[model samples]
Target chain A: MVEVKLFASLRTVAGEKGFLTDAASVGELLREAAERYGEDFAKRLQIATVLVNGKNIAHLRWKRTRLKDGDVVSLFPPLAGG
Target chain B: MIGGYMGKVLQVDLSTGAIESYSLPERMLELYVGNKGLGARLLYDLLPPMTDPLSEKNVFIVTTAPLTGAGAPSSNRFNITTKSPLTGAIVNSNCGGNFGVFLKRAGYDSLIITGKASKPVYLKINEEGVSIEDASELWGLDTEKIQEKLTAGTGKLVIGPAGENLVKYAAVFSQERAAGRGGVGAVMGSKNLKAVIAGGKKRVPVAHKDKFKDACRKWRQLSREHPATGEELPRFGTSIFVNKCNATHTLPTRNFLHGSYDEADAVSGETLAEKHLIKNIGCYGCPIACGRQVQLHGKNIKGPEYETVGLFGPNLMNADLKAIIELNYQADLLGMDTISLGNTLGFVMEAREKGLIKTDLAFGKIDRLSRTLDDIAYRRGLGDDMAEGVRFLSQKYGGEEFALHVKGMELASYEPRGAVGQGLGYAIGSRGGCHIAAGYPIYLEANGPITVDPLATTGKPGLVVLNQTTMEAVSTIGCCIFSVYMFLPKALLELNARSPLISKIVRSTFLYGGNIIGKALSWPAWTLPVPAPFFMLPQVQTHAHCTGERYTLGKMMELGKRVVSMDRIFNLREGLTGADDTLPKRLTDELQRAEEPRSKVTLSKMLPKYYNFRGWTPAGVPREKTLRTLQIEEEPMLPQTAMGAASTV
Candidate 1:
């Protein structure tokens, strides 16, 4: 099972904070998270930056980047001010 | 002897078309100091208790300090101070260019404008004299076109339709740079004024010229040596902070609902320099050429700053750098503040999300974004509502909870979710939600000697006050805040290298010289500490000591507090109560910590402590004793309170 944590405005759609999901690809994990939540979950998901464990997905293949069972994915939206 | 200042003030009344000149008062210069402080004092004195912002009675002032035009390093900035149509408080916005220098050379330290012009006109000041010229032909001309049409390469401060229409957040533009924020241009437009074109060949006289030269050398050297100032800012421009800020989760995106971005790399300064920048531009005598003349397609234009990049780019969910450049250009031409425009647009997008204003205004609709900008500036249909800015929009619609503004002014690029104290600063900031007005907790959150995790709430309120007060002084001096990154300590050092005359003055007056002279003069307790002449240092030797006055961290922090409290008092007199000073509900509640473990803003945990540190009442009104301590006159209109009553008074 993969653990994905949602933060900022994205958490509003994710319904809960972190959830355990059995998924193979990063795309699949997000899709499942959306299915379990609502359609707004997918639409609201664009704002967040995804991190596998502690490493950013930007270092890899972006959203298409694969995920593994027991892997941790953290999602955070952009913050503002000075 | 800071080099940038013209050491003069120009007062003009449009009602009779009369002009008056005055040498900046020595006491005022010593007490209130540069642009921001001088502005605070001038406006506070010149304006009455309940003056309407748009009335002929209001004064529109543009002020620069002694360090402004002086070949002083980074003294190439000036501020516009006026009553804001948006918030009806004191609003001062700074712009960097040759304008301040030109105005200074024209024999003015500041320009105080009152009354309304009978017709649309632009004020032209040359070596010959000042005249109010008909701007009927120049009206509606874009900033670049106006500059091109001017006879000489004079400094021109001009407004556009938005300002003319009194859009409230309209800005004044010159050479693509803007006196951004606080609707100064709107105030100017309300006065029926169009532009001010000024230039002069006269050299500004320096006090202790020899020591001034030495300070100039040192300041230049120090600026060149500093990593961010010398390298990053010069090479990549202010947009360089984009990637770094994103990495740290401080970048504002998606109407500040999110704190991270996907295509952050596309908008990074490094990317812009590599892809678009054609040449570097510098303001007056500044060594750091952070301004980039970017070439896109066949047109060359000033590139967007970090705030612009974040606002029009990722905040709208469009990461196209070229589009942002064009958007910035469009906004500039329209005389709209890019920050407020972007913020208002973001609010609209969020409204769309909440099923409020449905017109294809979604996250990544670039075409809609462009149309929306035009619509807002022109105040057409839904655009009219957006032009009122987010606060007005939220009120008109039904999402005050998600409205991303503090005091009507839209928040700047940096969002508060990642930096909690910044949120508090924005909430309590006197001039609505301004970052520079008091960028407190921000320094602590990002790059202070004492670092706090962005998510942390402790130590922020004190830090916020500290930032506000110090920034108040710096802006008052009319110097760029970037100097803080380079010469916070070295600016205070007093080793005389060259320029003997200036050296004596620096040693005798600036470098704790007041104490030495005061002791010698038998006035032990009355020695005044002069701000270090950071801008006046010789370019080559400035690295040995950064220019501008530098003080111990404690002293600097105290200055920040002083400015913050003074501004608070001004707001209190203006009828701002604690109820009006607060953060949006989402930031205080819905926005969660991403970096810090289980941390939220926890504003309730910080406000009381901040109030105590400020010596204000629990309700956040500045106490009469605090006002007395600051030497502020008691406001007669303050409601009388019954002893031990509910304290509603």
Candidate 2:
């Protein structure tokens, strides 16, 4: 199980700040979120920033980055300001 | 002479009641350009070393750039440059108020004000000319009240009670917008001036009118299409960074004791947009309209930026967005800077908890906050001391270890430990702890679409140099810094999204190319000709069109470098050494999290490299060769009035 958190436009689109899901990897977690939310969320998720436990997965394992039960996965879609 | 210039500068001396119109040199304009750069050069020429910021000898300059009123999007801005009472360093406070447009329209390129007024007075400038008017009644009024008392149909710059009372962190107000840092407002008050108003019917001429128009049109379109500038910013405003910063562990919480805040989302841009926003607003001629207008007690007012929210909210352990909004408005009305104000409060709250001072102020306590704001404005009780800013408070209260300042100015809202590069930036920043002046490297390290390893020292110094040069260059011509967001167009971000391999390549390129970019930046401007391939930076292009100059990438980078070098010399003359560029021990010695031993700002590791990239000695003085290359003469320049005629610039 992975804890997925959302912010900004993603939170608005999903209508929830975060939730728990049984996903073994970063790719599986995104698939679950995209499927649950719809095409709009999926399109955004493709380009959104993914951080596993405060570390960016882009420099990590990308979609293949494994997630443990306590792992916190945060998703942000092209955020601005500051 | 280039177009987009009024070509005359208004010089006023309140002591003798003398007003003169003069012109700046063409060489100076070409070298420094305008706004922050122009103002920095002007201050260096006009002021003596070690002059007291609040004394009659301290000079105040108001400068506008070519794009100021040339109908360029996000290009309407002005600068107020002076010595800072808070840090005793050079301060150039840029603002996006209507005053720049009005000042330019009134037929002047800049205003140089010196000496103290004989009495409480205000300045009025129009096509008729400039005059100092009696403002005995207007004195001591809040910012909103003073503006209302002034004549209508004019752009106004006024100070409130905090400024009048000589609070060190006082700010100048131009309508809802503020030149809100480094005690510029306090300097205005010291001169016994209350307000400066301008109105007229002059249009900024364009050298290449059609080309300039087309460039601006395309620039506007590109900005509109950028995800950060067009969508996220419009929807959430600057406070939108709350969540991102929090997630990245960059949010300043509990007096810089922690990096992340548990309740950051509650006071976030999203929350403000969802709960309190009345409408979206923007600065003059700005297309993004990133300013937030929210309802506070049934009256629509300006919203807080990320700085105000982070410092007032998470920094002080307060989570009430309504209270933060109220405090923000209150601070503005009082003519005080919310950044310094918030930091001072955080320090006091933490000091009280540590038994360093006896006060009712405590973290997460909101009841006394509003009254304390009033007290600070009026110089009453504990607020009086707090008004002096964090540096003074720490000195008196015996908490210098956790003072949370760089060279006496409080740090910005970003907790640099989360991004060591930002820490390096803050330490070496010319103005001391200002986020923008630090080149905002946090964007590349933590927030932007393509981020480097936040904790890695691998390529940070060269990267900081590249970023700082570009930022200072863009600022010189008067474009809003937000416009730089389009540097990463949506197309590239989309590519990064669809393809992981491309993302890796993009990240690596930015991370590794920094050193090469830094070296390339120092090349001669003539070497890099026009038509910089497919992606010409929108700013350099629009500037080239606005003024009939060959604004090449190298020339623009050189201008930015010269601006920084000019500041370096000024700071050196004013008694600040390279050693002065530093952060507090807490940020350097202690990690934000015990688990992350690498999370502290390793300034020593990057400072020498930064100096090397800057073409400065290890001690941080620009070499004679570097100065000559940049055309920065250490000797005080003869007045611009002596250099040329009204048609000069």
Candidate 3:
């Protein structure tokens, strides 16, 4: 099970804080979450930043990065302000 | 006449209670655009070298851009340009308030205020015209009370006791927003001015009403669709960066002694929204609604921004969110800049810990802060020296090494050591240590989701220049700087996520292409005739339509370049040299993280390259060819008034 967290607009689309998924990789987990949410959520996720245990998947293995039980996956839409 | 402009510039001589109006030239409007650009141009021409910033000889100008009050979203920003009482450099403080909108309604593109008033007075403007009225009763009052006493419908800009008492970091308040940096309020107080009110029934003229409306609608839609402007900002406000910055190790802590805080989440935006937020607010005609109103003492009031939170909260090792909210409101009512105030307090705390100064204000001690803040506003005891700001305190005491300021202005909450490019920005920023003026490159370096190597010195000079030029252009056109966040659209962020190779390539492009981009932008407008994409910069199309002017992305960027050049020239004439463009020793000489050998900013490694990219001499002065290309006068005109021998401090 992978623990997923949503932030900003992604939270609004998901309609929940996050959920647990049994997907083996980040891409599979995201696909499952997208199905549970909707096309809008998937569209937002396409542009969303995926962080696995505080590391951006872009710096890791993109969606192909493997995940295990207890792994915390965070999804965030592009955010900026200061 | 431009559709958005009132076509008049009002000049008030407070010494004689004389009011004069002059026509704003079409050529000046085309060249400078408006707001920051126009204000800089006016200051360069009118301000005499070496004139005391708080003296009657100094000129104060408040200006609005063409989009202001033209019903453009987030376009109500007004710029206050004056010689800074704190830094002695030209300071242009921008505020998001209704005053600019009402000033446009009251029939002026800009207002030039000079000469000290004979007595306490406030200037009133309405459709009936302008007049200087007695404000003896309003003197010494808090900002909120003063605004309440003014005419109900008029837009008012008022100062609190802090400004009246001439605190070096005093701020001017309009509604709840403030033009809150570089002692602009002290400049107002020095003139014996209390407030300025603008009210009228007139509407800003539009050149092509249909086209202008269409452009504005598209721009608004773009903002609404963007995840940043549309959702994140409206939901979380600017304080949303707290957790993000903390994650990136960019949160300023312990007087910038560290880049990360152990308990940043306790005072984070998520906590504020869940525990305190009453609702989100916005400036006039703003779609983002990025302002927060939090419930405190059973009443809702303006909440702390990211800068205030970082400086007042984690910087001092305090995690009390409620206390920060209360302090934010108190500071606003007192008309003091929270950024400077917080930085000053942090410095004092560190000084006390180091035994350099005798004070009970220790780290994480929150109880005495409220009283200390009040005392600083009223100039009581230690508060008096504190009111003089960190520079003065460091000068008098022995904490020069940890003063946490540049060019006499306190650095903003972004701890630069974490983002080396931002450090370079703080050092070379025109208005002392302003993050916005420095282009806020930390968004790319650390804060934003997509980022570059935070500790790298390579490619930073060009990055800073690019960000600075783009930000200056955005601000000059009267739009909120937040609009620039959408420039990196959802598609780009998505593209980066899909492929690591693409992300690296894109980041490399930004890093390496920066020098080429900066150099090309430094050239004259004719050399780069291609217009910036409307989707990326909707301001150009909207401005062109509203003013009936031939505006392009190249022309807008050129105007921004010219504004920066003129400001540098003003500083040069005022006697500031290249040596002044530097950070505190703590940022450059000391490391933020022990293990990360490159935690300190390599400012020397970047400055020369930055200068070259900007087409400036190695001494950081603009070259003759550079000035000619930007259409600025090669040499500044002689001071109209007798300026004594320049003081090179």
Name the better of 2 and 3 by DockQ. Answer: 2
Fnat measured on candidate 1? 0.00
On TM-score, the leading prediction is: 2
What tens digits encode model 2's per-residue C-alpha lDDT throughout B1-649? 8888999888888887878887777887888888999899888878877888999988888889999999999999898999899988899898999899999889998988888898999999999989999999998899998999898989899999998899998999888899998999999999998999999999998999999989888888888777788788998999989988998999999989899999998999989999998899998889888899988888888999999999999999999999999999999999999999999999999899899989999999998999999999999998889989989998898899899888788899999999988998898888888998899999999977778889987688888888898889889999888888777778788887666688788888777877777677666566666553223379888988888988667788888899988888888989999999889988999989999989998888888888888889999999988899888876545464533321121
Query: How does candidate 3 score on lDDT?
Result: 0.85
- Give model 3's DockQ, 2 decimals: 0.52
Residue pair clashes in candidate 2: none
TM-score of 1: 0.78
* Model 3, span B319-384: residue lDDT tens: 999999999899999999999999999999999988888989988999999999999999999999
**Which predicted model would earn the best DockQ?**
2
Q: Rank the models by DockQ, top first.
A: 2, 3, 1
* Candidate 3, residue A68: how far the Cα is off, in Å: 10
List, residue by residue over B214-314, the lDDT tens digit for candidate 1: 77766677778654566557777777656545655667788877776878878877678777989888666677877888876788878888778988977
> What does the interface RMSD come to for each candidate?
18.6, 1.3, 2.0
Flag the better candidate by lDDT, 2 or 3: 2
Off by more than 4 A, model 3: A1-43, A50-60, A64-75, B634-649
The full ranking of all candidates by lDDT, starting with the best, is 2, 3, 1
Off by over 4 Å in 1: A1-82, B1-7, B447-450, B487-562, B593-599, B628-649
